[model samples]
Target: MNLAHAAPAAVDEGMTCTVADGWWSLDPERPSQPEPVKVVKLKSLTTGEPGVWVQPARGKLTDQQMHIALRRLSDCH
Candidate 1:
């Protein structure tokens, strides 16, 4: 899948995630931390809307993480 745009789910970038490793690391202390290389996708809850993309990085996210992400994405409207 093509990512329209994606950055680290990081505080420095103004985003926060609870995951430690993977793309969810938002800890500003580990500024050198890297997001996964393959895409971690968060499926859409609404019809006709594209899934929220994590980028060209791949990793596992908890169910709660997905829910939070989807909810946040929905708020963009």
Candidate 2:
């Protein structure tokens, strides 16, 4: 696991996960970012099943943050 980097939780901004735990940018310095939402990812890299992507990201996400999160589910690895 990696410490989620300094980035914005904006879909169009960047998804610099290289390899990530989940989609929410966990950088505490970035309070302007959308809260991390707990969601079952359509793909889980570990179990190959859906669940909150731990080993991954932790959060306080919301519906408004969904756009930034959609990509997290598409990760088929």
Candidate 3:
């Protein structure tokens, strides 16, 4: 939750995240599109680390969109 030192550009390969709340609108600039999902980093099943990854929630996103969201979330903190 305290991602003050989290890097926004970190790789999300070995990371896992959970949606903290419902999906939110991305930016007000584009009202037509739904908001990106909000999520919190969860413990990595591979590395056993926690709070190291943060990215937009997945599931609804396509492969490309999920990739992009993962990258964006990496920079969230």
- Candidate RMSDs in Å, in order, are 12.0, 13.1, 10.2
* Each model's lDDT: 0.36, 0.35, 0.36
Worst 10 residues of 1 by lDDT: 68-77
Q: CA shift at 67, candidate 1, in angstroms?
A: 6.0
Pairs in steric clash, model 1: 37-57, 38-57, 38-58, 39-57
Q: Is candidate 1 or 2 superior in lDDT? A: 1
lDDT of 1 by residue, 5-34 (tens): 342332222233322344354555664354
Over 4 Å off, model 3: 1-12, 22-58, 64-77
Q: Worst 10-residue stretch by lDDT in candidate 3?
A: 62-71
| TM-score, cand. 3 vs. native | 0.22
Model 1 misplaced regions, further than 4 Å: 1-23, 26-34, 37-42, 52-77
